[model samples]
Target: MTINRRKFLGATVAASAALSAPMALAAGSGKPRVVVIGGGAGGATAARYIAKDSKGEIDVTLIEPTRTYYTCFFSNLYLGGFKEMDELGHSYGGLAAAGVNVIHDWAIGVDRDSKQVTLAGGAKLTYDKLVLSPGIDFVDNAVAGWDVTAQNAMPHAYKGGSQTELLKAQLAAMPEGGVFAMVAPPNPYRCPPGPYERVSMVAHYLKANNPTAKIIVADPKPKFSKMALFQEGWANNYGGMIDWVGEEFGGGNVEVDPNGMTLSIDGEVVSVDVCNVIPAMKAGKIAEIAGVTQGNWAPVNAADMSSKADADVYVLGDASQQGDMPKSGFSANSQAKVCANAIRGALTGSRVFPAKFSNTCWSLIDTDNGVKVGATYEATDEKIAKVDGFISSTGESSEVRKATYLESEGWYSGITADMFG
Candidate 1:
């Protein structure tokens, strides 16, 4: 019997709701307060779960800059013309209805000692436990001749929405036989398979309209996630259109000149009509301001996703350096559930389960042809370690590939509902 993922999600959420034993570990007087920063998968899910499971026992607030969140998970499909921009956008109304105070503002400062968060709008919120899920931000000057200012010209488009649209526009307007160059990010970035999926999407678009258009990828990492699957798809669907240069071939040594619309690899400069420069990334700025991040990412306790810098603070999603789990929306959502249960148990003496996390990243190789990689993880005392994993085989039949794509579509809907409501 085939278990539908959408139905499974509904059942899982129902089980969580029914089984929550909210033991009363009440503080002196009123309800305990929790503050969550960032509203994409991690923060929003954490806030909603805390509020919902607490059964009106705790006050929860979610601080985010945008009223609507755009997921980076399937943003590549937006470029592929398989999904519209609106499909990637979700509102916070559902979260608010679940008793989470959704504040649409940037969290600019985090005070560890005081357990307070200062917003860009000059407001302050105090929390008994603070959850930080601020996503990725590029390392400044990581790529030569590329900076925030140059992003308007070259378009990193990694953040979704406007940037995604900008990249799509560039792809549509490229001249016949024009060169499209991509400087892929290094390891430990958001969604390890994201850049390659993007290349496939762009190639799909160009193949239909401008068949002669070419794509050049200069990748810092020698091997990427799902490398074999992506390469096979590219060869089968977009043969001879993609030129992937790995680290050994000087892909690691890349410099860009946005002013001239050029990309230089291994000292060989090529004038490019359009460029997508994805720079090295680190935990978002707020994580650094919170002083929870060490090096580029924040370290967290495996049990509760609490930051090592301060037990009161928990970091999740792409901003965190948790073991085994890739920085994807699915991973973030899974981590949020574990973190939420822990926080609730701490505040109200609820029955917190052992942290068991899972993630599946689905990528579209061509229209209606998708592949995926996934794993189940358990939290060790040291880190969140992988228990088991699976990947789509290289030579799958067309029917199997199409079914996988459909499964991904089902998962997207189910996860969004789980996070938002």
Candidate 2:
């Protein structure tokens, strides 16, 4: 089923009463508090929705370390020069004005037993419900000769903000005919098509400034999302400027030398001007600290995104191991609405409705050249199952491609407004 703004609010209420869970607040307490960690698409949207819809009946506090959040969604456009850094950065002022208690602090600990969160600033906050949308953290030793300390030399521009800016600057400073290399991540990383899109954007930038510069991608996966479409776009737009090596060709067996500025792919060492190493990812440290993560990710109930380990806790976005959904911003935003509705129902004795979700991921191949893939999902007994889907065609008219790009532009504006406001 598809969900729009109106349908989201007008969900069909169930006849049964809300489930009774132990209230974290004592009787006559001012309000039942909800503590949300991470201020990205999922957490921000959930905090805003619960606060706005509850009408002062519940207290919502959002904990994020960064004061200004740079969205990972459109950050590629910034690297391609289609957008500015300011355009991708959003502030929490709007969420604060909408009644969310936005706290700029790191959530250092989550005590599920006590229903309290400890911050790095030495503050403790109690909550009736906890939401974790902390995104992804890289796995140590996932890539040879790469670690957090080497991120300065061989940067992993996976996360938003400074890392993105660093990569952009590196692209601009490439020597004439310089070699730019990227070590792609394994499966289930955030945004499956992200690294390929970055390569396209990087190629776009180099074609204009340093036409002789080249891009080489070493991917662990045999094939990625929108593989045919991305390959077609690369051939049509980038021509002979890009090369991709998959697992079948020894891309999976690779090592890097950050100090030497070289990558050894299939035992062939090549000196590189800039190396972007995106390693394997897992739920952020706080999720592991909470004791909710089974392995790398936290499993959640499809209906409400509640943690399988703890009903009082919910996990969203890339940190969640929900079935079928790609770890993308659009998916997280959709899941957040479903989670918010359930949280409000359980805490305030409001109406609870069946959960339905939808997501669309748009990628710009080049200037005004766009492609997309999306699906609608419904909650089943096992997981969030896909109902139907659509994807951009390999061969399409320029007019159609441009229209798709425009549609993506509209979506970016709409979703950001929905999230921050």
Candidate 3:
């Protein structure tokens, strides 16, 4: 089954209400323990909700290597010079203060049978339940002649933080009239409209700094999210600066030489100053290590996001193969709340509300010009099914577009606050 791609408010209400309830500890263990790996949108939110809602009844440990988590959601804005790197970075201190044991360390192995996680620092953590929300990792050889080793040269910047900064720096340093190329990913990748939004942002940047620069996109898919809207925005905002090659035009048949800095499309090679290669993605390594993954993703029951392989294991966000929800930060945060409630119920006998989800993806095309596509969802036996949806149109008024961008700013503020504190 194909998942529908898209975010809204419900978080502030849910967070405040959950804090009001007091849950009792499970009878068997001193405290029902939940160990979450990868402290991003899904893991951080899940850890915070379980700890906050459980009210000392459950022990929550979040194991993450990075102390400052950079959000992938708005990193494109950083590329466009609209946001700073610090704006995208959030410290884990909030989770630590919320009675969550926030450990800055890598979770190297998951012994599902033993109910233990081994850390790179040579420590072991035992848990009654394990939540994996490790976002995404690129598939091996998904893009020919490119790998993690070539990242410094080609720079996918798909993940956040340093990579994003590197990409922006490369963009800024490009020679006048130099080429900027992007090898777009296949379907089921993170953020359906991300690449196009990025192109728009890059164009915005170059138009101001290096007006003669050219932007090229080789997309494997025949089309993409918010296609008409994005195309229209490109034509209006960055005329004659962007060229998009879809699958029929051999965009799918491509290769990159990182060392030589050349991108070859349909056997036609051209040297580019900067190339952003977003490869196919899959669930992070920890899920596969836990033996909860079926193939590239971990399959979960739609109701509670419990692993199909292990009852005690749950997967959230981009790592999950639950039906009909796109791989997105907003989707992950939504899934985290549902997973948190279900886990709280199973461990502490707290009320487990029916699982419902929602997501909104807001993309900035130019200054004060934002467009979005979003939907609400409900959990079913089959998957997280889409209920209703909405999108910004092609020819919206300037006031409408500006309002949409401002709305996105508000969402970013709300969601981050919801996740961190």
* Candidate that scores best on TM-score: 1
The runs of at least 3 residues in candidate 1 whose Cα sits more than 4 Å from the true structure, single-residue gaps closed, are 1-5
Supply the TM-score for candidate 3: 0.97
CA RMSD of each candidate after superposition: 1.3, 3.7, 3.1
lDDT of 3 by residue, 225-329 (tens): 999999999999999999999999999999999989999999999999999999999999999989998889999999999999999999999999998888999
Can you give the TM-score per candidate against the true fold? 0.98, 0.94, 0.97
Q: What's model 1's overall lDDT? A: 0.91
In order of lDDT, best first, we have 3, 1, 2
- Report the Cα lDDT for candidate 3: 0.91
User: How would the candidate models be sorted by TM-score, starting from the highest?
Assistant: 1, 3, 2
- Please report, as a residue range, the 10-residue window in candidate 3 with the lowest summed lDDT: 1-10
TM-score of 2: 0.94
lDDT (Cα, tens digit) per residue for candidate 2, span 1-421: 2333443333312211132222233356588899999999999999988888787678999999999999999899999999999999999999999899999999999888899999999999999999999999999999999999999898898889999999899989999999999999999899988888888899999999999999999999999999999999999988999999999999998999999999999899999999999999999999999999998999999999999999999999999988999999999998998999899888877777799898888899999998889999999878989999999999999998888888788777777778898
For model 1, how does the per-residue alpha-carbon lDDT over 13-33 read when each residue is reduced to its tens digit? 775775377478576787899
